[model samples]
Target: MKARVHVMLKDGVLDPQGQAVAHALGTLGFQGVGEVRQGKVIDLDLAATDRATAEAQVREMCEKLLANTVIERYDIEIG
Candidate 1:
């Protein structure tokens, strides 16, 4: 089984890196950009036999170590 995890800032969290990138892009002549958010994607290959088990493990991984739940949100997809 395979699991994909996406970790991103919460809706109201301020992302300094994303802001910097957006600012730089604006300086480079990019226009009409409202906002920018940055996130991370992690791919994992697991030995679990079913999607349910894989999903559970992925969630555990995210909660335990992959993401900081205080300021970030994570979603897991299994295949």
Candidate 2:
């Protein structure tokens, strides 16, 4: 099975890296760029054959270490 996890900061959280990118974009003459939020994508190759089990395992990984649940949220996709 393959699992992909998308982890991002929740709304209202400060994102310094995102802010830096936005500022840089403006400096480069990119116009009208609004708020920019950055996140991470994690792809995993798993041995589990069942989709449900893979999803559960990925979700657990996110909850435990992949995401900082307090200020970040995650979405999982399994194939």
Candidate 3:
């Protein structure tokens, strides 16, 4: 099975990297750009055969180490 996790900063969180990217885009002639937020995608290959099991394992991984629960939220997809 394949599990994909998307991790992103929660609202009201400061994102300096995202701000820098927006500024760089404007400087590079990209106009009409609004607020930019950055996130990460993690793709994992799991040994579990059941979709539900894979998802549960991945969710556990996120809660334990992949995401900082204090400032970040995550979504999981299994295939």
Candidate 4:
């Protein structure tokens, strides 16, 4: 199975990096750029064949180490 995790800051959290990028883009003439939130993606290759089990394991990974539960949220995609 293949798994992908998308981690991002929760709304209401300030994102300095995203703001910098947006400002840079505007300077370069990429107009109309609104609020930008930066995020990360983690792709994993797993041997588990059971969809349910794989998803559960991945969720555990997120809860334990992949995401900052207080300020970030994560979504999992399995293929």
- Model 4 pairs whose backbones collide: none
lDDT of each: 0.92, 0.96, 0.95, 0.95
The candidate, 1 or 2, that scores higher on TM-score is 2
Stretches of model 4 off by over 4 angstroms after superposition? none
For candidate 1, report its TM-score: 0.94
Query: Model 4, 1-79: lDDT tens per residue?
Result: 9999999999998989899999999999997899998999999999999999999999999999999989999999999
lDDT of 2: 0.96
Model 1 regions lying over 4 Å from their true place: none
* Candidate 2 backbone overlaps, count: 0
Q: Which stretches of candidate 3 lie over 4 Å from their true place?
A: none
Clash pairs, candidate 2, are: none
Candidate 1 lDDT over 1-79, as tens digits, reads 9888999999999999889989999999999998999899999999999988888888999999999999999999888
Clashes of 1: 0
**In candidate 1, where is summed lDDT lowest over 10 consecutive residues?**
51-60
How do the residues 1-79 of candidate 2 rate in per-residue lDDT, one tens digit apiece?
9998999999899999899999999999999999999999999999999999999999899999999999999999998
RMSD of 1: 0.8
Which candidate number maximizes TM-score?
3
